[model samples]
Target chain A: MMHPSAGGVLKPACYAKPLLRPFGLAWIVMMSVAATTQAAPEALAQVDPPTADHSQFEPLQQDFASGREVTRACLECHTEAGKQVRASIHWRWEYRHPQTGQLLGKQHVVNSFCNNVTTNLGRCTACHAGYGWDGPDFDFSDDSRVDCLVCHDTTGTYEKAPKRGGRVLQEPVKVHGHPLQPPDLGKVARNVGPTSSETCGSCHFFGGGGNGSKHGDLDTSLLDPPPALDVHMSDAGAGLECSDCHVERAHQIAGSRYQVTARDRKGTGAPGQRRYAATCASCHGIEPHPLGSDPAALYQGAKLNAHVDRIACQTCHIPAMARGGVATKTWWDWSKAGRLDADGNPVKRHDADGNLTYWTRWGEIEWGEDLEPDYRWFDGTMRYTLPDQTIDPSAPVPINRFAGHHGDPAARIWPFKMMRGKQPYDPVKDRLVYMQLFGKTEQAYWQGLEWQPAIASAMEAAGLPFSGEVSFTETRMAWPITHMVAPAEDALACGECHARDGRMAELTGFYLPGRDSDPALDRWAQLALAAALLAIGLHIGLRILFHRRRRHTE
Target chain B: MTRTVVMFTGLERLWHWSQALLIILLLMTGFEVHGSYSLLGFGTAATLHVLAALALIVVWIFAIFWHLATGEWRQYRPTTRGLAAVVRFYLYGMFRGESHPFNPRPKRKHNPLQAASYLLFGVVISPLLWITGLLYLGIDLWSAPADLPLAPIALIHVAAAYGAALFLLVHGYMITTGRTPTAHLKTMITGREEIEEASQREQQPERG
Candidate 1:
């Protein structure tokens, strides 16, 4: 089948033609015969053929014109960008602000390219103008200043239409003030893979206080061999992004809501919440603190290690909701209330000299006797005894010091009998004296086991008639105050009772009656005064120093 | 009979030039990433390195499709007898300046050594670099579970990077071992090489 041409040239077309001879000849003959046969027939027959509507189709030229119009509409929305001029830090290139009393060219506030002007300069117009601005003078007052091509160029041509065409057909309005750039759009779309991070770093790493502009200290290179900073990027296997830690600044300007929130709540929350969107808790959880407990307990216990037991997990690790107003103190203020009585009721009593008395009881008798007949005291001691047991002559004798006045007067008694195997109890023949005083009445008498005036007085104070045989075992003086008690008297009034050789003289040496009278309030007042004086002094000194420095500099 | 031209198009030359430049750049930058060399001075090196790597990726995507559609992939298929002869020629005969056993043709352009190297580079080395580089990029985006260790992944990435560097050094040396000792280099630059008629049609058997 191969046809040999001159100079060893084999004809490919001629070789293939021979293979198709049978089919080709049959096709030609059938076509000729069918044409002649059909020519004389169907002269009298009428038929209707179907047709399609073409009204809906638009010309390609119309579509192209509309696309151009869409671009113009975008420019209209972003007017400042249309003039090809912006009021950015790049243009100002200075270090200080004329207004606002702020340093103009400071590293934190200035853009990378322009130290004098803020990042809000117009250089960003080329990259960030979402819509094209259309105005004679490029007035910012006009809303249609955003250019779609600035950020939508997937073909890498800055001013041309996007290579992928659906961009213009989508919502074309400038919904927000500034349109997000390409890197931002990529992130939102999630269309690109890990390489998208490089797009973000292109601008984020440069300008302002970012890594790029600080003397090339910030690396913007993404495709290079793995960099140390790669560990910080989302693609570097660490899953971090520029936006993970930084938020809000757009076109190098830091006046967005993110900046406001970050500055306003500084030092008030956890690291993750303070920096990012508070979404870190979704992954980290309330790690350091216990969960589902009162947050106030945490703040209260923050200073004391023991207090931490009551804190919840979210308190320290995550942002905890304050129980009360944030400014309110978490600690209880004891100065707001007076001392409580035996049943935790508020005490309201006065002595004969009209001095307020505060007291609580253990069981029956009053413990803190005021030495005034009308004053009531509640004692907090219980008394018990083992009877028929004698004390050795050498051992010290035990006594019920405040039997009738402070505690249950009718003390419980149990008889003691010497067992054969137990130790022997030899009774010593010695005179025993029991003193029972209730409300300044002293009753002391000694009898073998018979009725004694002291015992009778105790029974009477205890509200029991003297009928049973009584023997003493052990008696204790009861003082029921567990927590510190605050008296109603002010610091000045304390001297009336606490003077030398006065009613408080017996307890003065060890007690320092005046000090104990209102310790907490007095200490608090002294501290407050000292703090105020120190603060005033510091303020005055600093002011003087500042004024002197200013004068010297001037 | 189809006549094969010795000259290549400008686009083909551009692609080859860009690909070679990017591969060298990627290798150097990649080595620095492993803390191997101090060249490119870490920060600058890294930036340029990543940029070069990205350019390489773009170039590779286009080059691979071009090679396949143009039927140029046949050049990379390893042929045992052809490859052994090419190897022996380079190891022994090349030293004596003996004539090469195989000649360049449009359908069969690569020598056996070229075929093997290209296969290894395209199929093994390139994919390994890509996977490791991408993994290193997003390590923090999603951390492995607390129980899983990160050392293995890091090891794989680092190992592949070193392997690529080694391959690059060898490839650079091989490019110099052509006819006239600089013929391959010149061909890459001008996209043309002389072919001897006797060696053109001795089709070598397939290699591993």
Candidate 2:
């Protein structure tokens, strides 16, 4: 309870003097007894306050000497490096006791994963080292595992490990781990611009937990370069590095909430709140579009409008020339059923069924033919016949069945032989009448085969009796099937389907290929002006009424 | 007959109207910029915001010169006497229709509260906005230096913006503290205001 500033609240003279010593000792003992009694009237036993389970705490291993040793070792080559390390957060990774919020320093007794009373040797030292004492488990004397190069590079190359192995032979591994290596000192230390889709995807692509923890599927294969994803990086062809957007990597690694300062290229500090765009605009330019124009408009009106309409610009245009490519969501069947074919190629097709087919090739799909059926009605029912006799009924067929009838089966039946009442009836007329009326034949006497009633029975069951064979005219669908107009809910104008900017508005929302139109942004301008005026008028009217009433009263 | 005519010069009135209009525009645009309301129709709103800001800067330049030449800057000089009184009057007394301690005149138009508010608007809020805006405008020209940190600058910009927003809220509330609460606002519009009776005016002469 004595303050640090007070020299000596407890005097040695009082305790050492023979005459007063006894009285002082007795007084001290009496006071102690009284204080103890007052402190806890019910105290029959003493209990230690619960500390962090520090059975893991131990003497510093030989590997981790004092920070002084590490500093000295680092100073042997680079003296200022220790200062930088001191400013880093890794030096202070200890946690406070959860219950009391007390700094549980190295002396705290705790258990290790091994449940031993010895100092925490393995688990704690992995990240935190150089401390003389640790939890009961670690030995402070062990210096073999203390890696100085985890952050510091003494070799002047940023490589974590030496790349000595060649294509033909592997080099002998060194006993001592390789030293730290800094990047090329001569090269300008440019920040990696904002983290791009490629950078994010390098860690988050298809095989990387598709949409597992990330907000969206970062698989470059599945999605176009989304606008939210580094659009500027893709469009401008600026070589942006990860460190540019993820600024202050040495100070604040990703995922930590620690804040850090950023400077524009010229060192003028960023304006307003430190937001995502504040760091992003350092290289990508302040205004996203030219002259603060609408980005969507510029993209739609560009010479590459077809390309832009088909795919987002960012998908292909990356921050750097090397990074540019059509980004797609790598279709990882999270099911993880073997993705590759027998030859270790990505299985392009599940089977010939086309139902569950996925093509590995990028870009547009080439559509071949539109062998869709065009049925014509000759009687009550519709039908179309294929010319190929080898076509199997069970095999899946791409049939675009239009709603119309084929010729009546009563019109044609081949090789009629049956006679009705022996009047030498015309075989063609009788055969045609029988085939058309009944949609069946007793004559399959041709081709040396007997007549079958299966087809007729099947048609009757399906409520569509085959009337007659109607010929179909074939046509081929074009490559790069750009437009597939199916019946949608509402009749969309050309504008609705296309972008509603300058060019589209000028074209009056019509989808005429290769024609450019200017959009009507003035419509929005008029609306804004009217709204602003209305607000001002309301504000002014209120002011006037209030003032007029006040004057009359005065 | 001592007419209060020509008290606020034409340029002063122009500055006042334009400044108010620009502030409103800036606020609206700023809110939209922050993704608050889609009022100005995003793109055009942004365009108008820059235009109005340029207009405001021009108006501010002229107003600064006018104030310097006419020595009308004294209107915003803050004083301690009746400072607490003016604050208290606005805080509680005005609600009960209490007579103000600082009355408006040609010589001393603004009360202590008004002067303090104007000082904050002119010195702190306006400058902070202007500096930040200029920084934003010239971001390309003045690149962020490698050694210099951006966090502090961003913090200052955001902090100043919030401070201006707070000032605006207080200014709006004080606007309602006039005789019928709109007396001061009327004068800003019509460039004319009716004076209090001579007896009332004499009772509450300008405080130091």
Candidate 3:
């Protein structure tokens, strides 16, 4: 429960103690709040309170040397736990998008980060749920393979060693000249309980190789955010768990970054209550403003509702994300990677916020905080370029392209974090290659330092013929910002949208009164009004002259 | 002999002033909605504009029924017999101390210019303003297609506004051109005007 403090102080020693659980009486209030927003992981759907402690059980009483050995003993009591984990998307790294039919997930899609996990399973599977998926021969049907402790471990000591085929290291080793401690498997096995934010945030908060590298909205700051930082996640405020709105059933979480809810034709559940869609509209209807308060309410409600036909809820609600003071990765230039320091070791540099700004193994990097999102109409669909798909070598490739614009009826303008990366791509074959990133053989990019053989071996394993020609291609990807929702009072003011140079000026296509003006129409209207006034002037002059003439004649 | 001529009924004066007040209110709020000037926020301005327009329409309906039921529509009937003289009087004859050529009667009250101006105001400008305003409100409320060209509709509506504005300007001067500067205004308030006995008896109005 020691979600590292938002002040950038990460202390593993502080996390060993168990936090105050959503205890006896407050547990009810926390459950009621879960219907809308509650970050307490125990508030997740269908979660049951434990009847007996695992430490008291004879199965977990024995000392275990490996996580797999611990898993075998736990299966004797909880027979169905490992089977449920195997069926989750967390196990199967591929998901078929319901709307686009595009097969995407950590396995099927090719992103600028670590490219693909094909040849890098040793290091990448540190985040994977099952063991021995190093070369895709791992059995999906094995129930004993799922690591239930990854999510269920209440003990703070469970740590998986990177580059070990997803196994917890049983021995201490040095990593980049730093001493490492092996996780105590026997202690972790005895302490299994309902998941907490710390357990889920373990892999999620440090994605894309470092803290706040992949997802802009998530970072160490969310561990213990304030109401001003994130109203929903702040333990001081709503204290919502990620699984509350992203309600999980069995093991499949409701929300996905791969597929999102752009517009909710189905309005909110109830006033001030939450739904399980992980969307603002799941809690607040399109008509967010109260009606019948004034005569304008009807027109205002309709006007705001009309905007929902093309703009997303996050466009206004999450004005700027990554505001929790932890900087997110904004740019990555892989072309500059592989630069050695004075001692010929891998050079690594950090930014002011302690984010990885540069690394000899990766590239020149940029990190930023409180960033404004790039607004685009996204109808909840993203077109991804798969590992084997043909790419256009003539232009920069988009790892994932956001869809929709003004005229698209079903599309809504959503806010996104546009990340730019320079990665290796096959020029002659027009495809991206997965290098043997962590292997110690001559084909590994890190150990062998040979790009040609490394890519050839990777492409051969992926069932694609390599052209032997490689080029560093600039790539772009957009991640939508749907978190760090500000309070309603902090939402964009009218002048922000309706001014001469408004925030939505270029993004929105309409004749906004204050923002856009038709000079031709304006000129004509002004002339006609002037003519009417001029006619009145002529009438007065004529009347005065006639009156004076009459007086003279008399 | 004491002579008095009934110029306006109390209901007619009430309708005239109330309609004027409503139009003025509509104009104030309507311009703000158009972003021309800000008297109130757009949301409030647009609501007030629609409400005032609706009230004006209701008042117009009552006035129309009163004219038809009471046979007061006959007073606005035009004749070409003295049309040129009336025009000339407004132009130059008034400077030469000449009398108005047309005589007033209950059944045939307005001169050709007055009848023509009122006809255009009621049939053309008023109708155009009402149609466009309603169409705009309908579009805003999603009752009509949102893609309708609001620029042209607004242009026509604003033009009609100018027409009403012109009527107000000229009407202001005409009231002062009566027997005295305040004569027409006083008659509108009291429903009577002093006139020669012959003119008053020449026409006996069939009162409703």
Candidate 4:
């Protein structure tokens, strides 16, 4: 039974009313139900998750055969989603670096991996957030081409395979004489929701051809991490997602490596105010250690606190990388490729650690586990080598040169995974050439054997003159290792950096007491003290001699 | 009087010289480990220092047990009974050729100043060095305490080493105060010293 006073507005003022009022019980019940029905949507919107069940929607009930069709279906209600996706880095593959004002993007930057995105649209566009990007003329303005399922798919089966021209197969297809089933796109599109580790890892974890290759710290092991492996991401621990630190507003993710916030001094900024959101100092402030009054949390070392100025948080937090039972590629030599068996099939070799040291695919690879990162001064800005940039063949050309050097106030020594490559370049022009590493149709390199036709066709596609002269040149790139956070106990001990042969002994232009020597200064100080002592002894001997002479005279 | 007194037993001299050699070895490598100009490389210095510290500890154990078993520990008993006389002799009386107030015997080997300094070294400085050195050695091992104020602890250890070095200097200077400059130095090697036998009954062991 409902009271008339309580039923009128469902206000807190009428909650303690025990007696019925002048209105009828039937009318009160009817009015209360109507109020509840009206208030339901606002209550639903203000919870932990804002997403509703998409399968219940009438448009999503129909089967989706293509990624474009799924995008079309998604756009029926979310009319502005395609426009938002178009402006994102994931969609445009472009970012004008704020510090350098350089046109640095995945499409323009030539990396030391498979090199660049040019002349290999069909193979590279598999990870692109659009469909049918098979050629240079692929329309960027096509709203229906935006891929909603790649990031939104709740079903694990949704996939866009390489060499398929960014097309998702509707049915099972045979590849390399092995039958493979197509992902259930219809079920994935219908059940779209928040992104999981699997959705993000689909492209990120598998970067540079293998799991844990490009970023040694991030890999498939992060999918379901143990508490010790990643304290922040572990389900049994703090259980935070990537979106917690790399916060997103609208559709644009807040953090990026290219525009890194190397030193975040202003502390945490508002969602739109930050340059790069994923910084340790932003959340915990500059002095993070010995966080509170608790005994276990406090690593109360004076030296450790002083070291924060010169070294990045990742340098100490992540002592050894590729710790999740995976090896990262430390070397890639393309000059060793084209070694074929007697049957004309490409041959490969593996090292004692079972790392694919000699892979016929793309280059001769070398892997390392638990690698100590190479450190260098970086102030976030970097120079990307454009295809038009001329190279000096004498030295190993840095693909993306990390800017800043020792003694730069804005710079700090950051750990990076240095990859050395002997990749293809045009000898006559002295410029790096982007090769078509994989493609299925036409003059694609994977289908069409040898480098001559592939280089000619690829150069023609990219609108660059290849003098028909190709040679491998030595190149290197340093990718910063930022993830695979260990527990506080596993961090580097104080003595590891303060001991005689410490890790930071070779750090340039620095003077450390335990790791540095000043024999001249030490000797001088000791000699000064010894001389002072000798002077005191001589004064006493003189006093005694004077007193004895006085006594003899008396 | 040409009387001979056994100031140091053969075992006592053996322990004293062996401990001194080990301490010198420890300090050499210890300073090298501190990057105070390395003689032996860091790896060799660290290993040798640890080995020498362990040997010193073994020698200390035997010396302490022998002193307790043979009742020779009373030789270091500090007394203010003749302290004023000892100080005056060193300050003024020694220059005027005055008679000595205290003499070395089988049971009393140290003057008041020597006994006090030896006590400070054994009870305070040596223990501080041992505790800090052992704690530092356990680094990279499971026994190392987490959340320790390591820099301050290291500073304390270095300060203790400096204290030991200063003690060595003062000890070297004490040799010149003997009847002859080489009298005490020869006693440490030969375990005997020349003394007048005025009171033979006074050589009985007494509890400190």
**Best of the candidates, DockQ:** 3
**Fnat, one value per model:** 0.00, 0.00, 0.27, 0.13
Return the TM-scores of chain A for each candidate in numbered order. Answer: 0.23, 0.23, 0.81, 0.81
Rank the candidate models, highest TM-score first: 3, 4, 2, 1
Docking level for model 4: incorrect
Ranking by DockQ: 3, 4, 2, 1
Better of 2 and 4 by TM-score: 4
DockQ of 1: 0.00
Query: What is candidate 1's lDDT per residue for B1-208, written digit by digit as tens?
Result: 2233665567778897898788778767655544444555543454565567767888889988998898877778888866778777765555444557667676787778787877887898778878656554334223323223334454555556555655665566567666554878888787776665543344443332
Provide the overall lDDT of each model, using Cα atoms, as 2-decimal numbers. Answer: 0.35, 0.35, 0.71, 0.70
User: Over the stretch B106-157, how does candidate 4's per-residue lDDT look in tens digits?
Assistant: 7677888788788788877888888877666543222367544344555566
TM-score of each: 0.28, 0.33, 0.75, 0.66
Looking at candidate 2, what TM-score does chain B attain? 0.82
iRMSD value for model 4: 9.3
Better of 1 and 2 by DockQ: 2
Q: DockQ scores for all the models shown?
A: 0.00, 0.02, 0.26, 0.07
Off by over 4 Å in 2: A1-329, A333-554, B1-7, B36-45, B141-151, B197-200, B203-208
Candidate number achieving the greatest TM-score relative to the actual structure: 3
The digit string of per-residue lDDT tens for model 2 on A449-514 reads 221232233223324434433211111111111111111111122222123331223322222221
Scanning candidate 3 chain A in windows of ten residues, the lowest lDDT window is A1-10
User: Where does model 1 exceed 4 Å of error?
Assistant: A1-554, B1-4, B141-150, B199-208
Model 2 residue A307 CA deviation (Å) reads 22
Q: Give the alpha carbon lDDT tens digit for every residue of A1-554 in model 3.
A: 01112112111222111121332223323333443332333342234446787888888877787777888898898787678778788888878888788877777677777777777877888888876667768888877677878787877677777778777866787765657688777788888877666778878887877777778888878878876666667665556666545656677766777777777775555434435566655544455543434545555555666566566867877878788887788788877887887888888897666767778777788888888888777877788876577888668788888677756667787888888888888888787777767787878887765678878888787777788987888888889888787655566655455556557666655555445555675677677667867876787787778778767777
